[model samples]
Target chain A: MTALMIINMRNILSVIMLGGIYSLISAILFVVLDAVDVAFTEAAVGAGISTVLFLSAFAITGKHHDLKRRNHFPALLAVLVMGAGLMYSTLDMPAWGDAEAPVHQHVAPRYLEDSYAEVGVPNIVTSVLASYRGFDTLGEVTVVFTALIAVLLLLGAIREDEDQS
Target chain B: MKKNPILRETSHVLIPVILLFALYVQFHGDYGPGGGFQAGVIFASGIILYVLLHGIKKTEKIISLQTTKLLAALGLLIYCAVGVAGMLLGGLFLEYNVLAADPVAGQHWGILFIELGVGITVASVILAVFYAFAKFEK
Candidate 1:
């Protein structure tokens, strides 16, 4: 919450730093929840790589943004409305770690029961990710590939133009 | 940025260890909490650290932008090829059961290869993007 407030400030570097800290904290939260894989990913990508990437991009852009104060009431109202809606929806959600939650009752049991027999991996997450949901992982890889290609096309074009001149 | 011998020396010692840890994370994911994505990010951060300490120019000479681009494509190709190989073996696309005599063994192989592909592509693409951003000002 404090990090969100800090992010609203004008300094870009501090905002990025705070964002990284927020991610790191969330990763710790994930660890406390026994989601070690998620914590690993959040720490590596969110806190580590993204902070460096932001700094690199910042080198190309400006370090500070022009803060022009305008009417923020509409945005605040929208956020409040959305927050209220989300809160209302959460009331219907099962309590945290409830055994009879819809998710735990559904496919989780099947994965837990048969993953080792079918996929032969001790880590159920890997078995599920790489074997059971192979297509989805492929699509994720393609998305990463597309993002890289987009960045290359955007920035590499500029380099080519400069070299030609 | 001023050149500091301390920074350079520390990085020189640290980078290899970081890279080794990434490899451990990558291959050890079968039993542990990490896989390609986490390992890839860690690996890329190691390279980024090298770039920070030794300068982008020197780092680029070692791992060229062209090579990074190729690696990104090659990784994707490796993944697609594994799927195609499964198809050729008369399984559905990305179906690992037909890749070997034993279905479970085939799955293990398939997962390893695909994870390797994921790791390679992610690491290279990230490094390439970083290079593009860093080189834009030059």
Candidate 2:
């Protein structure tokens, strides 16, 4: 176990800093994967809005967390089994960033090379999202719309008495 | 309603740049690392800034929660209408090439309409989310 800082202030700062680091790392990883749209979404959602929302939630709910360690045996065992299976599968996979990987030889190359001529767009990612695999993009838009609906249903209609209170 | 002068001034300066950048992103996606979603978020963020600095109640008067809900639905309809137009043109569902008699011109028209649909949907949805959050806190 890492030694806890005696100062509570240090712990809070460290957690916020750690979250910033994780968000930064994920944004870079998304860029590397050629998912610029996903990267932008994450950067805004995770780093921007989420941080504000969390802080607001904390303000409403208070700072002290309910620290009881709920039962963990099942969760730990499940995670361990999943990790072992993933390690076994990783052995048969092509090395990271290998140009000879089957993924590189597939239709992806066609999407990369011919997407401009095929779709008449310079950004192949947008072309893919708005044209080639448009149905999937439609699904994504629906998911966002559905989330808006859910947020509305969950917390939108304000009660008058609560407002008065 | 009196607000913190610094915040109001900062947002006054900031919102235009944000909206301009969003339009730039919407148009530049054909060449750069931006598209409908990014532009939409940037645009929504500008509105959110207004709400944050000026308070939700006042912002509501300007945009209104009811209008936002209607706009959200309208955005989806816009996207679907474009797809339906493609279908009517005798291509496969979402097939853009048949929209015009000339295939190249058809692709241009199709991509333009689709991008517009995407932009509209994204902008509205982002606004709706902000509205949700603002409403919840009140």
> How close is every model to the real structure, measured as TM-score?
0.95, 0.83
The lDDT values for all models are 0.89, 0.73
Model 2 C-alpha lDDT per residue in residues A1-165, reported as the tens digit of each score = 112232222444445545655676688789999778788878865676655555554544455543456787998899899999999999999999899999889788989898877777787788877888889977887887888788677774434224555
lDDT of 1 by residue, A55-125 (tens): 88887777477587799899999999999999999999999888888989878899999999998989898
At residue B101, what lDDT does model 2 achieve? 80
Model 2, B1-138: lDDT tens digits are: 345787778788998898899888877877787777777777777777777788888888888766777777777777788788888877788888898887766776776777666777777776766666555553
Candidate 2 achieves a global lDDT of: 0.73
DockQ of model 2 vs. true complex: 0.49
What is the DockQ for all candidates, taken in turn?
0.76, 0.49
RMSD values for the candidates in order, in angstroms, are 1.9, 4.3
Give Cα distance to truth, residue A149, candidate 2, Å: 1.5
As a whole number from 0 to 100, the lDDT of residue A1 in candidate 1 is 87
Q: Candidate 2: TM-score?
A: 0.83
Q: In model 2, what are the clashing residue pairs, if there are any? A: none
